[model samples]
Target: MSEKTSASRRAFLRTGLAGGLAAGGAALAAGAARADDPLITDLEAQPWTQYLGDGVDAAPYGLPSEHEAHVVRRNVAWLTADPVSSVNFTPLHELEGIITPNGLCFERHHGGVAQIAPSEWRLMINGLVERQLVFTLGDIMRFPRVTRAHFLECAANSGMEWRGAQLNGVQYTHGMIHNVMYTGVPLRHLLEEAGLKGSAQWLLPEGGDAAGMTRSLPLEKALDDCLIATHMNGERLRPEQGYPARLVVPGWEGNMWVKWIRRIEVGDRPWHHREETSKYTDLMADGTARRFTWEMDVKSVVTNPSPQAPITHGHGPTVLSGIAWSGRGAIREVHVTTDGGINWHQARIEGPSLDKSMHRFVYEFDWDGAPLLVQSRAVDSAGFVQPTKNALRKVRGVNSIYHNNGIQTWAISSEGEAENVEIS
Candidate 1:
């Protein structure tokens, strides 16, 4: 063979051998990557897998796992002067299901949480009644108890966004709300026992807090679904949630629920209290305010892919989850939009759609590595549909700080990051 032909043959063999080695190396690397996920993919024993967990009575009152420490109620320091008489938002982004945990529920107090001993507490029912009555905690428990789930929302929830999308996560904007099962006696039976006068038009519920929170509740609502609750989520009410007893006014603002309830006075008209006229009232641009806006409208928020809970995995099958609720009635349906409201598809409503309670929803789809503008709209049994921010502003004006139940938008980038945004 010629020298040039021999050299060419040798070079060709070397090139082919290097290429084969490269391919084998890539395969070995891929196998190692798969092997690294034994904690999730493999059935091998791990630290927890090999050992036994704590026994039954380890903790008489159990707590959540240590992994969930970040899931907590947070207060915006600038929103109020002090933590005691201020507000703290629920960590809605980390929560799931319809019922909110007792400890994680939002906290709002005008004077601070009251620390009243249940043994010393007394409930007074007076004014416009055939006979005034005082009942102790034990007396309250004996009055034909009932249990039901309901959502309690502050009328000022999302109030900061009236002018613009001021907050990032749903916990900051819409976390001033919570849903839980309450155990108590109906206010109707109690009012009937007291023999309400025909002339009584309203009931003034007062709390024992230093601020002495008070509100005028219509007689119709008092006889409908109002509850003087002492237990929440199958446990005794937390002190922050008005321990001992609080009025659970279903379908009304949280402020009207009257934590640490002390007295009930039957009256003929609204007392025009500070909370009703100066605080919770919606002030419009034209100077006229919408007063007594008690019931929260239909509202929904995408929880999983929010600012705090962003998409982390590569584009593929993605499950979009959220929560929807209304004060008027049960949620009938929820529609999700991923194209800035240009198109919408019905999301799967999960759990029991109870009256005046939160409903869980989920929408699943394969992502195509494209930017998304996501939003959710809820429809209540009363046929009331959630409105857009622009549509709500048109009716109530931007000056209104309370009752801002407009639809929210979360913009997701192609890289799987999410942010709060306003879409035209």
Candidate 2:
């Protein structure tokens, strides 16, 4: 190393440092200029500023910001024949945190969302109960009210991918679920009001929709944590949801949470309804079907790097985030695998960690523009670990369409786009 070469290198380093400092100073100056001469600097001159704001009665019913118009329930046209007797998925990718907003929550109706007036709603307890009693909306509201948060997940949440990765977005694959704080009277109180007959072992809750959806719930569950909810999140239940009142079976299949609940008929046996018999049941390849599978297994999905939400920032510090939940209990932990299933890392679970509620989890890492396979695995408090598609298939078979809690895999290309992929 000659002195002349060393001097030249030293001079280059000094020039580079000065240039960098000057660029940073220029950025600061630009920021200061923007602060001084902001787009809204002359607020008084603007139309909104010049005119008085709309009066309190302008919008009697409040609505979300116009910018949030995209955040709403979406339905797959091909999935069902008619919109009336169909399902709409929640916009999970557009949502954050645990609670699913009332309007944004997914809607599934056998016949259609019944538009029943609160004043006209009536709940009747009959069948095996000692006394057959009918309680109006006012009468039911008189009972002790309690608020609880729980996730109501459809049994067929990820059923489309049970055979393979068919869906393109998180909303299609995992949006048939929602968590909300329900304010209502405990179902036990109502059952106690109409003393349960000793022979009562099952309770069949029937909806008031045109199709009259009905499902047989176990007596133990009815007496435990079930609720007859009237409000969701902080507002009255949406029309799509069971407005006025709906049965809430926490930590169970969403179907069992009968919306527009009208009747609770206690019985000694489970009614093999069309829902439980021909539909929700998981059929095996061996010609046998799993029945009464109400509880949703532990599951999680990476919402950020999913197909709908691709990585756009290029290589650097990246946050991989998603939600995990269980029908059994609170999510104990969530694991993320960036290099496929070969390597696994524990994700940080952010909470309120309420029982049977959605939990957010995040895994941060440095990406270097590498093509990768991203996946998330959840473990519930019941110690049930989420299984892979292959593992789930080996046990339940490919014919089964429900309870697909398989670890979802998202393949990220070198260009930073992501797609749903099934890996061996």
Candidate 3:
């Protein structure tokens, strides 16, 4: 090598062997420590492996790594009166790719987990239906089935933050959500089988679980791409995630998913159930409640560089990746900010960019060993931009819990750790 080139290489190692740093740290360290160290010329390396003798031989079904054992579905200690009425949040900060494992899907029951046997399960259509029909699990399956991926998010997500970022981590502020592919017969198919009468304008879906959770859906939505899903992420549903069956309301809040789904009643008007009336209403600053706020607005948050997940790897070229989505339509833009949301930069989104599905985006930048306030913004195909915390609070007061999809920010320390914060 030329003398200047050799000198520059030595300087680069002195500062930090950054690129492929996770793999090249030792290579550079060896050169500075010992002259006889072998150079690492090969660009590729073998993945770490544990032979059969290392652990259990096998399982009827596989699971995530034990290293991921810390990841779990969490519940707010005092959100509700009991478990059935409480909410369990998905560990969004801990996940990477889409497709939440069925076991990890967040649970929010009005009563408690239901013990329903598929043999006894029956879905009945009544009320304004031209032909009232009750179908067994097998009968429902006899019809055609379709598989699609979608995200289920509780409207109350980040609600605690409205009062002033009460929660410390994204796991708490933004974990009441999950994205998974469902395999099941579409709700439209079942509705068609029942044959809705001309008078039918609304539908109420009830769950079989102890709480008997229920919600009213507009007839237009009932027949539009809804699914009575029996499987999540390519497997039978988990007990906590609505075993046997659950409703999948695409581009809508999770509460409407109606886990342990059991019955559908066609109606002429909204049933105005407790969930739609007193619970899900978004009380505004003037004391007026914005009821029936079903569509979750476009929201985005930096998953990593947050309280639970920190930038453990310091300096050099770092990848800032996060999740973004819109209920109105497909996400069109997701901006990132190294210095909070003051000046934003476009992120490089990777993976599938489907309509009404989660889109993963990444931003690469050089970390200069300084404190940073990282944030993300999502814009939908409808040209609607995600609202700021203040903008949302200006309308919906801090007392409200549902339909708050404000942009979230993460503060990164010089030590490389991250914490959730609000940045104007």
Candidate 4:
């Protein structure tokens, strides 16, 4: 090699080394600046970092962290006469994603939770069938199994807000619902095994609890997407969720999904039980009643920045998140408005868009810390848009307590506190 080429190569190597050293020095200065943050500087001094955690055997069954103890199901004492026959609300504001944790799923009991031995559980198919059939839990599990995700919503959810906004928190007003994946055998497969008689038109599913909660379902719907479920969210059903077995009636109200389900009696006519005639029916202004109202309408609620979950971070870049669902189909879109209904921005829907399941959505914006009114409107695949409270009252007359799917509004102060409010 020539001396001139060697000298140029040596100079290029020296310059490259100097440039690399400068970049390294700049990175070191940035790291020194970040060292001032207490979270980074003191992290090694924390107990969790310095000490070993509990062994795996310490928690035989896993549990939530101590910091998350506040995330729980809550019940309103005045909502019912006694705790046994009351309903509890899910902590919707504290949850994320589309699926609700099994432990935190909202519960509604007419006679409290019934604890039954799986070995003694029996599902009897009687009336209007070629043969009376009784299948044990073991026998039911032997059939072909299927899994599906669905949302179960009580008919009376948000019932208290029919007249006006009475609940201060979204947990109490919109928490009587949960979405979970169920594993079970199709009801049609079981009915086919039992041989449904030609005269069969209706089915009466009775619960094993003391109240013996029973509801009449149409034969067509029963054969469509119903299931005799034994598992939820990949685990055995919880005691409050019906232990041994339960019924799944997709896209329908929760009353029809009988927990601790024991019997299915085929009949030719509807059985106007107390729950159907006196309890679940919607009273109209003309002294009439709307009965057999099964499906839950398209609904959405802003879970975060709610009354219980106030925005404590003050102003700056803010994240607004919520959930929307529909019994008819999937949620196609969700629109959020910060100035009541003056302006609406389409929220980005995240997670899976399953049919008859909850859909999570998020909207990010810069906040000026001004007093604002927050609201969300949902549009479902069926093209049904969520209505306002006053618009719903104009048609339904506020004489009933069931099936209130109106849009909810939360008034936010400059301080970031939120409260339930209805806008005209």
Candidate 5:
């Protein structure tokens, strides 16, 4: 071959090889590349890249990737007497967006998850109602349905932190909450069908679980946004979450969203049940107790860069994300601070800002490898602002466990390790 032809062919081969490497580098960077990472440089030799993967039938019901097994609902074994009657936290740091997955939603049970067949389940409306009635699961489904998204947060969420920073991770500190789209019949429609008596002013919803959990709810609230939820996130309710039926008391504590709900008794007065009187009430420093504190206050937390989720990639272009919510109304704004409240920056609120639902917020900045203190504060549409831990203590006192929506702080070290912390 002539020298000129041979040189042209060699140059073309070199250009083609460089182009391929450049394309592969871009793909690797998108997937979180490492300078000396074998996964990127030897991608073609990886087992999964060369093999035939599982078929469609492998997962009868779709499941998360095997790599995500670490993301799950977890319980602190020391928190309760038994697993059946205890609570498990959602892995908040592992999730994104507003909707919580059915499997990962937090679980709080008084007796344990009830496993009643849908065919055998029933809902009875008794008490002061004009017409006492019992409807089968199928019967309830026949009513006019509405779908709405809301965040159900246990009053005890962050309860452990009322005194100090106790839990090490966001999951345990603030994971007793989940947001999902619910499809169900309005409680007002059901009450009207049963004919509420003129004197009916309260409701006592009872669960079908072994514990038969019950709570007293105001009649006015029931007629407002309460729902007889049958499905969550477009699927039948998970057994841990109320199964065939549950109550959706928008903007209320999780206990009021009675799972395995089987009956609602309309009454002329509050039942002052165990949940409301002894357990869920807020006890004050002066020995006075606060009751009927139903609505969850404005709250926000830095989920990523929390103790469980630290910044793994060092130094530059760090993205911080978290969730904010309020039982009163939609969140109007969320402000983040990187220096323990000394300086605050407005975070960009992303996704739908629905009433009484979770809202995701993000803040991105270039990390300078300095030790940091991160926190987020939320403001709801009703003008309620999330309080600082000290500010909350001033009003509610440290003795109270429920409804503690104080801002949370995470101390980030120079190496990017995060720790749950409290700042004066």
Candidate 6:
């Protein structure tokens, strides 16, 4: 590479870092040389250690680098009167590799984080059950267990965008969603143990948190794939994440995943609680509301090329990557757009793209840096292509939040800085 080009690439690295690209520049620089270049090449020319610090010097539990301190879950202080009733956003700009760390997953609580003990914690299953059973945490352990990685998304995520782009980064706009591996007993095992009666069709699950969140769920889902998880990513649950126990309602809104779960009452009808009724309802532009909208529509976002992450490679084989997901099933396709919505190229999906799970996708491109716009559209196993923000606005009419699965665009300048912007 010429000195001028090398200088330019270094400048791009700094520009991209400040703009918020999740992948570290130094790591990229270390391995920048193309493979099969020359067997006699000296690796000392690289910036990072070929094999970083050993054992204890490295994290016992891995963590993002110290340079990534700005990446964190943040909540708007005034979103609620107190922190107890607030929401925190996951640092989408600072995360990579799909699985969000257990400690940094966003939190939304109506009543502060609950402190519950597994010893004293007991789940009562009653209502339409053949025999009302109150089972302690120990009783739950007796049932067979299953493991899976699923994303939990709060329904009210991106609520601030109704009046245009109120928040700056994707962290606030799309951080409400997080993917994690969980180990727990399936909901079916518990319901089977309680012996659901023939009339049992729905369940009213209640949480032990101060919020006392409760929601009615179909028996079909309860028996299908839901889990009662106590561990995330092989560690004890964090206090803010409902430590002792939490109901894992797969592919559904987070509100229904009752945290610090305490009771399950099988019922015949949906119990319209404060969360399901008054709060989560979507106010449409037609002056009507969309209620009981539980299924999170298939959605995808380009995490890089946003304010938190920007193109720092200056026009070489730049790797563009992002995450795609669907509540319906596995992501079948992820299309990338570099020219706003005018043109799009399908990204190569990599890693485990499981059903109802987060799928990481990447597209390599040479960027000229001339003003650019980027977005990612996901097509799920159901063949549902993620819609653009304008398309969503045309139908939903930018009225409210509940399911804003619209494709988001990131505007990039010649200098490589990026910011959130919406385009047709």
TM-score of 3: 0.88
| Residue 283 lDDT, candidate 4, scale 0-100 | 92
- Estimate every model's Cα lDDT from 0 to 1: 0.89, 0.87, 0.80, 0.90, 0.90, 0.81
Task: Write candidate 4's Cα lDDT for 219-335 as tens digits.
Answer: 999999999999999999999998889999987999889999999999999999988999999998788999999999999999988877766555677899999999999999999
Clashing pairs in 5: none
Residue lDDT tens for model 3, 210-252: 7788899998987888999998888887777777888989999
> For residues 1-424, what per-residue lDDT tens digits would candidate 6 score against the true structure?
5798557545634644654443334345566674442324657655354656566756766787777776678887877788878889988777778798987899988898888777888889889877789998888878888789998888877666755655657887889989999889998888888788898899999988888889888899888899999899888778888878899987888888888889999999898888877888888898898877887889988877677566665655677778888888899999998898788898999899888888899998887768888889999999788986677788888876778888887888886767678765
1-424 per-residue lDDT for model 2 (tens digits): 5798557534533533454455445465763544444336777557776777878987798888886786788888898889888888988887888888888889899898899998899999999988999999999889999999999898988888887888777899999999999999999999999999899999999999998998989999988999999999888888888998999999899989999999999999999998899888999989999899989889999988877666655677888989999989999999999889998999999868989899999999999989999999999999999999999999888889889899999998875667789997
| Per-prediction TM-score | 0.90, 0.88, 0.88, 0.91, 0.91, 0.86
Q: How far off is residue 95 in model 4, in Å?
A: 0.4
Clashes of each: 0, 0, 2, 0, 0, 3
Candidate 1 lDDT at 116 equals: 92
Positional deviation of residue 249's Cα in model 5 after best superposition, in angstroms: 0.4
Q: What is the lDDT of residue 179 in candidate 4?
A: 95
Question: Which stretch of 10 consecutive residues in model 4 shows the poorest summed lDDT?
Answer: 8-17
**Regions of model 1 farther than 4 Å from truth:** 1-33, 36-45
Better of 5 and 6 by TM-score: 5
Q: Is candidate 1 or candidate 4 better by lDDT?
A: 4
Candidate 5, residues 1-424: lDDT per residue as tens digits?
4698447534533533454456555555875754655765797768798789988899899999986887899999998899987999999989999999999999988887799899989999999988999999888989999999999999999989988998778999999999999999999999999999899999999999988899999998999999999999999999999999999999999999998999999999888889999899999989999999999999999998877776756677889999999999999999999999889999999999899999999999999989999999999999999989899899878999999999999999885767788987
Q: Where does model 4 exceed 4 Å of error? A: 1-35
Badly placed stretches (over 4 Å) of model 6 are 1-65
Model 2 C-alpha RMSD to native: 10.5
